[model samples]
Target: MPSWDNTPSGTMTAAALSLPGAQPPSKCFTIENYYPKPTLPSQKWVLIKVKAAGLNRAELRGRNGDQPAPPEFGMFVDEFHPDPPKVLGEEFVGIVEEAGSETKFGKGDMCTGFIYGGGKAFDGAYAEYVICPAQRCFRLPETSLSWDVLGAITMSMWTAYGSLFEAAQLAKGATALIHGATSSVGVWAVLLARDHGCTVIATTRKKDKVAKLKSIGADHVVLEDELKEQLKRLAPKGVDCLLELAGPDTIQTLALPNLAKYGSVVVTGVLTKQWSMKDFTPALIPPTRKMTFYSLEPGQEDIEGVESVIADVISRVESGTFRSEMFLDKTFPLERIGEAHGYMEENKAIGKVVVTVP
Candidate 1:
């Protein structure tokens, strides 16, 4: 067990939200001292000294007070209530400062993973130290990647993996359409699809990102308006898989119509901030096609499977199959977290936005 006596300070700095969804990003957070440094909550939880933390759209939704409610029937019931003043980063890469008696990790082991209600349910990675359940943490492999790059990957990459392989059942030769291609998860989805031997068609609202998406291994990059026409020419048989990140705004009109006879659509992230379709019905879905939602809520039965996906991601990065550098869009010091949130809210970033903790 690590001794708290040797620790430098009992207080840590963090960006906290006292009132969510009431103010702009610039005015939403308050950086101040958080006292009595967080301790291990259980024998299965580890304390992490955060090196770098990644931002997610979920945090934005939390800050804006517009997050979708958890599914009523799953393990997520009552699992997502975020009580502020709270810390809000969902993913991070860091060094283990203290390990639980039952954990496989030890002090100084580099680690990264997701925290379910990070910022809302508890203090998150925005601080110098954060607590994570041992089962949710992944021991990172030896690599040359910087902390910021690794920090930007965890949650987004995991979501992409779950959506493509687990939820959508993407095949090696499938044609994958990644809507909202410039978002962090969208970028990873594109790369993962290409690496898995699929032809990737990525879509973005802006014309400038077309080249960036294509350069990242997308076989075809089309504007949202041009997707219908481009798909007719690129894949007349229709796409085999669709990773819908844009949510209700485009899923019905743009996504479902472009699917192959037996294609699957995985609705993962709601980037548009719209929760439900007005007057939705099962009849809207085409016959023989399927749609599902994907989420990585804590305490799910399949939580153990995260370790394998993390290992696969790190292995690909180490073997040079996945380009880790292309995923980082910007980095901010922990003090500039408000700016980071603002950047993501404005859609100014192409990939992941991370915060480096000193």
Candidate 2:
């Protein structure tokens, strides 16, 4: 088996949080070099030389101590240790530096995937190297897409795919409403829905992003305040599917009432930072409408299911059906991850903010 002895370093620098609270974004993180390079625990794992890692809201929640306790059925329970000084990142794209005998990946293959217990049970992609289960990783297609672009898309695209197709069963010719349309996942949802032949109506809080959203293939782009009025005009029968990414703030006020009689609302993201809805009741949902939640958590699906969804997304990108470059908002070096998190918290980014590892 290949070993870290062959690599350039015995230890690596990683962004870690020693304390979790509402501290300054930069203050919450520290670059540490004392941690030893992680070894593959078993043949089912691979060691990656990470080139780029994607920033996610979940990490921010972790830093703020806002993440809820793991569910009883959580698959990573055995590995999880949410103590301070944890590395924080969920998605990455990199070269397979070392692969186990049982895995299909080999040295030098480009790969991208999500880490379910990243920053907790396992060291995350915020470092120069990360260990991932072979089953959770996907080989990237031979394409011209940049590493940052690939990193940006992995988790966001996976979430969008699961919400649109797996959860909602969105069909061709359906009218889809993407709430929080300027978010990275929302952007991917817009593209996926449009590619699937749905008439997409995207909503954004900022008026400045309207043109950008429309250019990316949204049939209509409306401000959140104007959603109902515009939807009435554009999708009079109500939308066939609603992707609620803004979370509790918009779910009752905007998402539910605008759904078609038989529409499905898939809650895929919580851009608002509000975890629960105020006074939410069963009566909020109409009789014929359905509401569901989709997450890329472990145990949600099998390895084959994850591989299939990622492959479908990659195939679309390779075929030019989805423009990978259109989804990247910014790239920050690992040293500047705090600034990247700040940017995301400000809601200033139109798409994914990626952190590149040196």
Candidate 3:
């Protein structure tokens, strides 16, 4: 009576792309009926009706062949299955349409989460339906946080959380230097760090965004070129931590000089889109300093920690103190995914770009 093929009439649509190749966004990304709605893979997974998904720089780099396939490539729904034309979205907000036995969530429960392998190892939230581990997903409260805001938070907020707390050990009264202050993660880091009682020194290349960054809890905003000089005036004792979201060039030129003895530096992103750092060596850092690279790619063992942080972030977002909406620069219909990717690739977007599924 419950036939698999009898479930739905239409196929799920996604912005599909090829891998290990470079092409314009228009040519690389195409909207098509990419996948049929996926079935529950196990008692630990759930099928979601995706509402919105955020486009990230990782997906862009993967599409443009700027980065190679992750080692986990070809694994779909936790299996070593080779499925391609991959659907490209990593972070999303959706409603649980079907749930397995082990999940606390039931059918129709609204949810949001980010997964490292989504859009890579399997079909991602760019589709109308996506299947992911229920443990990797979190149920959301019926609150004022909209779908777009929830989607945007999945990647940027998680990175900010891990960078500030786990990687840098940022504590109240610490001083943080946030490179690339205009980025979505940079903006969130400034807010999150300030809320945690740290004095934030934010940096930006655009003079126009100085006031904007300062308004979001940055105690001091410095131009990227003037980072070293301004930092000396602002924090003569030196920065206790630096969230290096910029490229290696900034880390070499601006960040190292301002680091305090015993300070920590967390490298999380490459806004410069350069993966390799030329003329850089570990010896360049002071022996007293600590360096950590924060990545959201966690194994099964780290799920509880990820869940705990997501819960805390949701509580903060619902409290109205987090202001998640401020970081959304633009949103597009699913069909306009190309334009969205183009906007980010061109470095025109000031914050997160989201794709809204109808």
Candidate 4:
């Protein structure tokens, strides 16, 4: 068994970045080249032949010269880069080719986990094969879940699950006000909440998306701006839970007030603009409610529980209890990776987009 505390457990290959970032309008974009494969370890690691990987905003930020590789990733504070040369993608779904001795998983299993250890500590999933700790993956049903959806769903689905069940401690009869219902993660939250038999009020920006939210079993759908007023008339008492993916930037006019007692606001995204609530002190009349933000990073204590959640998601998706489309709105071959980042930056797609390994 490889020891995580004393030695390197997972094996890694020498990184080769072919295209790094966007190119001139006339020249087709591609990723840049980097060092050769650097061999690491696989003793306590699982080798995944990455079949598909999703395009996420964080990677987009790194690719677009916005997100810099942080200190923990081995780069000094002064020397980090976020161009196409940096390995991209944190989430991917693939078949495990081997397992670390310390881990319970074996080769040929399919799974995915959040990899926020930084672009340096963990190479991005846009590759032929890579390694991850055993705890980062979970087994999947033989006939269920497309690799694309499985890979894409894990992060969003887990966040939704953790936030609703663990973070919010929601009850069966609670009313969950879910913001950004059109988002991939937002829609998943609605499904998980509905699965618990909760009344979910889904909010979206486009009225055309109302039907989409309903198809996912939302009890009510309202425009983003109209969230508070519509719920005021619909639920009257205020929502018991608010699943916020838009972060702290969203306007507060739609605040949910129908919660019975000790309602909660769970924030996952940072779209709320400025976080000024720290300046305001709420009076103690609303039954001692709480506000919290969900960090998708799974903690050490949650290793096994997360695996259970992964199994549930895979089982449900395979059983038709959860029906999801390939979140891939677009794909760029490994060579055209630069262009892929550009597409995400352009904000053209609605669901999850991925860069397919050629």
Candidate 5:
């Protein structure tokens, strides 16, 4: 096995965006010493032997330094300890190696969750073993679903659930227009919207994915160029909610003033890789309609809320109401995580690229 340290027996290998001497974005990631099953600091934390870790676009953004810590968050800097270089993955499916005394989980249980720090605040799930708060870890059913599929569920489904139900106030019989309909969040939004008895109008730049979108319960699928006409024809009453996954271009062109009175638009994913909107003003929105930019920052919400979201999403996935395998594009072994990152950078992956940690 390739390693950065001579003591491979004592530590597990992890793919890090930038180790002590490594720079990011354009540079290759390095595998370095990652301690598996570290000392338990408190009775609320649990150690996990990572089986699979899912790659997300946010990790790329973190690699490029696109996200920065908020100023107020600096107040807690005193609580942080000097640790090894940060690892860069968020979602994972793993086996519980050690459950804390107070945790309800047990050893040998199959579990899944998002690392609270995740490449920013602390070292994350790009390693063979990860430690997370027990409340954040949810139990998984004994099913034939691949680890990659379960890994893909956490971030995407949680983001979709937050955006649709929490932010947009989506309801049964509502009309939802999802921009970037082929994205992971968009795909989940479509499925969830359909499951809730909503009329889903989905959009994608790829014409070939139209039928696939319809098969997943989209009431109407339209090319990006034909969005306006199709929305007018199918939903006549402006959509009740708009899922802005494509970012600025879609928000500027499709969101503002394009809703029923009291309708909302939740901006979530930026699949367009574009963040800013030019010449934008709140005046563009019609009276009574709202536009919200939703964000699920780590540690931003209470532990109970995060745990609830994870539990609900996991239950939905197991019940067959939400198909977890639909967004999986491919998997790579831990040593080839660079290839996985490269695949995602190329925009060739239709779904998620995961890394299998053995």
Candidate 6:
């Protein structure tokens, strides 16, 4: 019989799983409940007994029927061998139930990595069981690493690290402007930039989020709509760097004439509102004036650099110094998955809304 455990750091990753007499694989959440069928064992795969997983906005895109199901073994199986519908999930921490022949992971190991999107392209952490590759799995430190905490940081940390180091190349004491300061990455960016000695000016559309942002160590938090006035208050010299999570829509805001000489803006969103700057002249806000559209896709431009820095971020998380409850405002049981999505859609959450798998 398939078995499970709830002790997050224990041998079992799943709080539940198939038993010998249990019915065939079937999904528990969402509109489409595909039955689980047999999945092929891979030379490079590991079976994770999921304990908990964190939610990201990317998963919402898939849930809205926008993206393809996560790359399952079936897709690769057709290219490699035949497999069945795989579970979908992204950021999760669980015990390794099985490891491939050449894997660095072993049975009973606790690890966390990107699950992609749960219930959409991938069978995410909403379920008790999940399968992944050893290469994609990053091990949790033996000490002080809690499952919930690990799940919380993987995605946000990766996004923040990639933007700060790879895209913005943030320098110590640089003046930074962060939009959506109350969001998970926004809060993290504020804290991280501070660690580097940067002075930050942040923004939020809702005024009530001010105290929350300040609690997380923000230098300043202003309403999103007040950019004109807020920009004045932040000093007319503009900023040395801007982190734009507001997406394509707000790109024009960074073009404000107030930006400092050679300032940079690193972006990672798809919102439709936008800002435009007309000066294309090399002498003016030149193309040499940097702008980066940050995406966390796993590839050569990021591959090694993203992993190493995330490892460092995880180390900080392990130490508890980098822990930010700012993103963990709400949580749901695996069954309340629908409500969780709705809560996020309402935009009522100040930080992160996570799902507990147990």
lDDT for model 3 = 0.75
> lDDT tens string, model 5, 207-312?
7788778877899899988888877788776889999987766676778747877899888866666666788887777889988877654455455665666666
- Candidate 4 lDDT, tens digit per residue, 71-133? 322222233443433355666777876677787777677767465443434565766566565
| Candidate 1: worst-modelled 10 consecutive residues by lDDT | 1-10
lDDT of 4: 0.63
Give the per-residue Cα lDDT of candidate 2 at 347: 85
| Better model by lDDT: candidate 3 vs candidate 5 | 3
The TM-score of predicted model 6 comes to 0.76
Query: Candidate 2 regions off by >4 Å?
Result: 1-9, 18-24, 69-74, 77-85, 278-284, 297-321
> lDDT tens string, model 3, 1-358?
2111124335788777743354457677667774566777677777888999988877776677654334433223343333443677777898998888998879999888675577666667777888777656877666577788777776687788888988899989999999887778888898889999999999888888888787778999999778777877898978999999875566766667778988988888776766566788999887788877786543533766766676777778788777665577788888888778888887766567889987
Q: Evaluate residue 200 in candidate 1 and report its C-alpha lDDT on the 0 to 100 scale.
A: 95
Best by TM-score: 1
Candidate 4: misplaced stretches above 4 Å? 1-35, 41-44, 68-85, 118-121, 251-260, 272-287, 296-301, 326-350
What local lDDT does model 4 show for residue 219?
91
- At residue 134, give the lDDT of candidate 3: 69
Task: Write candidate 1's Cα lDDT for 74-180 as tens digits.
Answer: 23245545343277776789999999899998999989967755555566788888888776688886767788878877778888989999889999999999988
RMSD, model 3, all Cα superposed?
A: 4.5
TM-score for each of the candidates: 0.88, 0.87, 0.84, 0.77, 0.79, 0.76
Worst 10 residues of 4 by lDDT: 1-10
Candidate 2, residues 1-358: lDDT per residue as tens digits? 2221123347888888766774568888888876567777778788999999988877777777765445311346554444522788877999999899999989999888677566555568899889887777888767677778788788888788889998999989999999988888999999889989999999998999999899889999999788778888998878999999888567787778888988999887776677677888988788899988887555556667766667677777778877766688999999888888888888888889999998
C-alpha lDDT values of all predictions: 0.80, 0.80, 0.75, 0.63, 0.72, 0.61
Root-mean-square deviation of every model: 4.2, 4.1, 4.5, 5.2, 5.6, 7.9
**Candidate 5: residue 103 Cα off by (Å):** 4.2
Ranking by TM-score: 1, 2, 3, 5, 4, 6
Between candidates 3 and 4, the one scoring higher on TM-score is 3
Task: Name the lDDT of candidate 5.
Answer: 0.72
Q: Better model by lDDT, 2 or 4?
A: 2
TM-score of 3: 0.84
Provide the global lDDT of candidate 1 against the true structure.
0.80
| Over 4 Å off, model 3 | 1-10, 18-24, 69-85, 248-252, 276-282, 297-312, 315-319
